[model samples]
Target: MTDPELTELRELAAQGDRDAVDQLVELAGERGDFDELRSLAAAGSSDAVDVLVELAGERGDVAELRRLADAGNQDAAELLAELTDED
Candidate 1:
C-alpha cells in the first residue's frame, strides 16, 4: 500500500472505523506484521483482535494466543481452547 493509503487508513482506524480496521489488518497480514495487529488490538480494535487470533491460531502461536486471551479477548479465548484441546 502507498503511504497515502496507509496514512488514511491509520486516521480512520484510530476512530474505530470497521472497514479501515479490516483493511489495516489485511495490509499487516500481507506484510507479515503481526506486531502491528497486536498493537491495534491493544488499542481496543475488535477487528484487529479477531485477525490476530486467527493468525496466531493458524501459526500455532500459543504464547501470543494466551496473551490475548489473558487480556480478555473472547475470540482468542475460544481459539486457545480449541488449540489446547487439539493437543
Candidate 2:
C-alpha cells in the first residue's frame, strides 16, 4: 500500500470507517475479506490471517503476532518469529 493511501485508510479507520478498515485488510491480500479478517483465526478466515500477518509485519505487535501464530496462521506465525526473534 502506498504511504498516502495507507495513511488515508488509517485515518479512516480511526474515524470509524468500517469500510475503509475492511479495504485496508483486503488490499493486503488475495481474495481476503474484511469482517473475516478482524475475526482472526477463530472463524477459519485465512484472509483475516493474511491481514493480521501483514499488520504484524508492518507494526511488529508481538502479542497479536503471537496469537495469530498460535492460532495456526502460518504466514502470521512466520512473521511473528521474524519480528520477535532474539537475534
Best model per lDDT: 1
- CA-only RMSD, every prediction: 2.3, 8.2
Tens-digit lDDT string for candidate 1 (1-87): 789989999999889788888888888877768888887877777767778888898899989999989988888888889989999
Estimate the TM-score for candidate 1.
0.74
Global fold similarity of model 2 (TM-score): 0.51
lDDT of 1 at 17: 84
TM-score of each: 0.74, 0.51
Clashing pairs in 1: none
lDDT of 2 by residue, 1-87 (tens): 688987887687667676775676566454434344564334344445667677667776788778767866777778877876855
Q: Return the top candidate by TM-score.
A: 1
The residue pairs that clash in candidate 2, if any, are: 37-48
